[model samples]
Target: MVKKRIAKILSFRYTMMAAILILLAGGLVLLPKYQESEGIPAEQLLSNIISLERYVSTDQISDKLISQDPSFILIDVRSEERYNSYTLPNAINIPLKKLLDKEFESYLNQDQYDVVFFSDDNFYADQAWAICNRLEYKNLHVLKGGINKWFTTIINPKKPNENMSSKAFELYTTRKAASLFYGVVYPDQTKTKSVIKKAPRKIITVKKKKKMPVEGGC
Candidate 1:
């Protein structure tokens, strides 16, 4: 059942991409420039719009978080209120509406980390990706199926049947471990109590201190 639902969500990606490409094609000339470059050409943007490489899977994201990899950034494209209520671990909010703000330029334009955008589903995340892609940002991706997929695949993964392939069970085992890392309490982990899921606390932003330039450096 969960697989079916996720499949349905993924199937909509093409339709959404088409609509977004049309909108982008129509408005490309009107887009405002943040950097000196006027952004990528229409043909390149069209190619990017149709490619599947722009999506990063939930499994990949889970693995990165588990390993504490710092080469990637998760951008929650939802509302500020929604973001304050709940979001994936280490995700920072950059509401879809404010994605292009000058304040966030460093986050979106940098080559330091692979930037990922996500929302409840892929709708808004994909929009964020399209916008950034039009601006020719590198290392940008949309979380495939978004947070809903993350909850379904990582937080509370479904167990595979006995008849399922060994590969399936292996994946299930990995997901189980990932779930534990995220603090999910399974029924078996406690006595006489059902599983309890707790939402992580709201995000707290810590600004990094800038380094001072060397006095003698040219």
Candidate 2:
């Protein structure tokens, strides 16, 4: 009888200890972990998103580049291969994958310079912009058309029609000059007729034979 009584007391003690451990674990989960600024407030985050004015035109960027504006910090969000092939002057490459890395957050989470992001198109750059904007980072902007648009406007500019306004002509001339400075090739005004050639067709031979027996003599 005494042995049985001691066994019951030991089992009850273990049960109580288990219950206490479970409660402690739950309490830890309920406690909030800390961070630097606690990020953007919910209400203000919504307001900033709805009121966002986050695009900068290629023409404006070009003007800034020509004037050597120190406030502009162009960010290339494409892969390293693309960035190495071609990128805008004074632009830094921080691939979309690494945008949130600690090494890059200093540049991304600040308002000192006008951060302009660009990719082959607007897609990747827009994504980077969204992340920074969500974090309530200030002075962040996307290159309206990205590098492709830059090529269209500042590189291979088209001449305005004869009836176009002088203002249009003036803009074209500026783009032409910018193209020269950037060492980009302009479309030749002299038209060249394109000759289309057809690829050679391949010949196939068909063979007929008696059906072969199935595997394992099926």
Candidate 3:
């Protein structure tokens, strides 16, 4: 009888422990859902919690550059050879390998410039941005689509979008109109022709003056 009683007690203890463990496992699964349901937007919550910065698009940057905004310092994070071959105008060539060096800290720490990083692709820029972010440097941004998008947007501007703002459309139209009037659009042909056609010269004859003697008699 005592043996049976002890057996019953052991079974009851095991059942209780199993129930507690199951409840804990169930809570673990439901906790995330519960937190998500508490009116917090997922992305915003994550962003607020993390130390990382966000990405900025090339078109947006091109617009800012066209507007002559001096808010950001553009950094080309490509290899020396690639950087030399081609890069955005006004961008400093500071390859990714040298990003973390102490010699660069002065330029990186300048509060006036929001350091904008770019490369042929995003990988190099992303690495540089990550390094800066880890170092707790503020006002760092990664150029979305990097140099590839820069060429697409700045060098080869596309048609104005239907959803473009009135100001943006006006700016696009103004640029187009200015290109026609200023001959900047068809530069090679128009500018060359204008340079080739010389205006008629006006030659004026000057009267010869009497030569003056030097003060020190030669």
Which structure among the candidates has the greatest lDDT? 1
Off by over 4 Å in 3: 1-53, 158-218
lDDT of each: 0.87, 0.83, 0.71
Q: Is candidate 1 or candidate 3 better by TM-score?
A: 1
| Inter-residue clash pairs, candidate 3 | none
Q: For model 1, what is the error of residue 43's alpha carbon versus the real structure, in angstroms, after optimal superposition?
A: 1.0
TM-score of each: 0.69, 0.66, 0.52
Tens digit of lDDT per residue, candidate 2, span 62-86? Answer: 9899889999799999999999999
Ranking by lDDT: 1, 2, 3
Off by over 4 Å in 2: 1-38, 41-52, 185-218
Poorest stretch of ten by lDDT in candidate 1? 202-211
| Cα lDDT tens digits for candidate 1, 95-206 | 9889889999999998889999999999999999988888878899999999899999999899999999999999998999899999897767765233243322212222
Q: TM-score rank, highest first?
A: 1, 2, 3
What shift in Å separates residue 111 of candidate 2 from its native position after superposition?
A: 2.2
Q: Give the TM-score of candidate 3.
A: 0.52
